[model samples]
Target: MPTSPAPLAPLDQLPIRGLTSGDLTACADLSEDRGWPREEHKWNLLLTAGMGYGIDDPAGKGLIAACVVTSYGPGLAAIGMVLVAERYARRGVGRRLMRHVLAEAGDTPLTLHATPNGKPLYEQLGFVETGRAEMVSGRFTPTEPAPGIPTRPATAEDLQAILRLDTEIFGLDRTPMITRLPAFADELRVAEEDGEITGFAAAWPNMDTHVIGPLIARDTATAQSLVASLAAATDRPLRTDIDVRHTSLLTWLKANGLDSIAFNAVMVRSLPGLPGDWTRRFAPLTVAAG
Candidate 1:
């Protein structure tokens, strides 16, 4: 016979503590139970670059809720990985974890890609919709290779240049998190001009589909080159979450074979400190890590 889960403790009495490496498995399990796409390596990257908190069951057997807040430079922070065990749902556990992370965010403006279910909670906490991001995926047919911009696989030597370009476009220094990407990415491609790195993109395996993202470039042509390179490298269906603000880019992506599968609101709690020039951000690293 299947066993019933133990009843949760009262919300007010649940103890919260800083999440550590020891909690990675439990946290991954929490996300898996909720049908989220995160794997252990992704959880490890988040934990390494940000701070997290969790609430344990009253009996101290395991976690019932958890959240993470990743800061980029001093101007922006992203809140993600919010999860609550089904047995503990509707008991204020989500709110408590969110509040804890918000306090940790301090004075920086915060952003999150909110699903319909999470939008209401975020709205109650002062978040307002700023924009929309759409997830697009499909079988990709490689376009004719881009010309004039030399392209090659990224190496350790290229990390510093890539970080600078990413910081300029992302409006914050995400070196800590970005530095860890190569280890998880199936391929990291860089675009160069006159031996100077101008842009880059990465493709990582996600379940059955491969995800390509953080595609930053100085212009549409360069962005297209990076995307095409990534698409050609993988035979599996490819997916990416792109900001809808770039109409031309969206149109081009559609013309290239990918189709929009899902959309989410980009919500912010304060004035967004985005760079004056964000045209280079063809796609975000991920809605969660934005």
Candidate 2:
């Protein structure tokens, strides 16, 4: 009997380049295959506009075997949109992409929300487990409001103010929300007091889950109100990723009946030069999108 043809060599060992439009399409298709919504098409486009790298198929077959994106902050860097084609699994493609992305990060502290399968790889790269997150889901009713705070859908005039709060919370100036606000299903609510926008939250309906995110507030009560308000807005079950560092909010979530799911891996590769408060008020986008 004739010997079987050799398996395709792993794409990991090759040098990669910047992603092009064609690569984005391939990435989208691969994303769909991985169970992500087709709406994730914007992720590739956003990654290209922001910061990302990828290894393309040499045959111009429109296959992006591996890819990664890094968003820069004042003194930090965040990794998002990481992917390795199913055919290229366990071939060091992720490692290669990470190594390259970190190199380009240029000393900014690197962080990401790693999946269970990715935890080992990140640990091998010197990343340590940092925290947990609770994906709270439940039937919620709004609590009685306190004095002097109001929640409402973000308006055009509120964009700059909301963005400012977001910058302060995430330690970076991100334009994605500002540009995509109109199209996003999220309410992107803001808390106003004395005519000033104090806090903001982006809550939107996912497939079966309604996700509340980047939920920043001036105080725990305000945050609580925002959470409750968003929940009341959606008839579907509500969910939000509560960072472990926010013990007060996490406790509230648990007390209110949101089950604690698995932990979210917060890993950092380098130290940043700025003050450490970035973790205090930092807002999360999502596991993959952050």
Candidate 3:
């Protein structure tokens, strides 16, 4: 039988190279095959804001494994979109990719949201569980904009203010990624008070559903108003990933028609400083980006 296909080479010997725009479709296919939520636009955005690597098939067919590393300056780095084809599983592909990405990250504290299936491997690599995040989804009926919480679509003029708010809440400068939000998100809502941005949120398409996240606000009421504005903007199925520590927000989400559907462990390779105002972070931009 053709000499048994000459016995496929071990994964460790696969060539690793920097991933580029040419790899977008293959990367998206890999993620979708693994039931991930990433799409082409998200992959493109990630590639623009971060660096990615892939182990290509020796025959020049396509990628067999891939991983992405993003730095929020030197303060924080995140590793995500780690994927290996099922045919190549259990052959140390994930570990090798993690090692490569970590090397690229230098000494920055690393973080990632880990599914149960991924937790063991991450833990083996020295990641510790810091907390849990819940994935919530459902259709919601938009309520009238909350009084005193003036909201409007974000504009170029509002970019600086939004970046400042994000830095304070996320404890890292993610200006590069945040600046690209308008391209991928259907709406970027900003809540203003006293002529200043107090909160903001992004609503983006995710396969068959819409997701609203990276919701930052000075208080719970403002957060609710931002979410409501996003809901009013779309009647499609909606989803968000929220830290479980925010019980009040969780309750509000459920009351507003969303239900918790999944839980992910927030794992960190090193202890990064806490957000300047953790309470202001109502939701993360995405599990992978977090």
Query: Whose TM-score is greatest here?
Result: 3
Q: Ten consecutive residues with minimal summed lDDT in candidate 3?
A: 141-150
**Greater-lDDT candidate between 1 and 2:** 1
Using Cα atoms with residue i matched to residue i, what is each candidate's TM-score against the true structure? 0.89, 0.78, 0.92
**For candidate 2, lDDT tens digit of each residue in 1-290?**
99987665556556777766556667777676566564353564455546657777555555555455546554666676677766666777778888887777766776778778888988887677666555666655433333335788888988878777776766677676445654565577878889888777876666567777767788777787677677667777677777777787766766665666667777767652232344445346565545
Whole-model lDDT values for every prediction? 0.82, 0.66, 0.83
Candidate 2 has its poorest 10 consecutive residues by lDDT at 271-280
Per residue, candidate 1 scores C-alpha lDDT tens digits across 134-215 of: 8889987644335446678999999999988887778778888899789878999999989899889999877777788788
C-alpha lDDT (0 to 100) for residue 1 of candidate 3: 44
Badly placed stretches (over 4 Å) of model 3 are 1-7, 59-61, 142-148, 272-274
How would you encode candidate 3's per-residue C-alpha lDDT over 1-290 as one tens digit per residue?
44555666778776678998788998988887677755887788778788889988766667879888777877778787889877678889988888877777777788898989999999998889988899999987543334457789999999999999898888888988898899889999999988989999999988777888788998888888888888888879889998888888778888878888999998988774344577888788877787
Winner on TM-score (1 vs 2):
1
| Model 1 lowest lDDT segment of ten | 141-150
Cα error, candidate 3, residue 228 (Å): 0.6
- Of candidates 3 and 2, the better by lDDT: 3
Error at 276, model 2, angstroms = 6.1
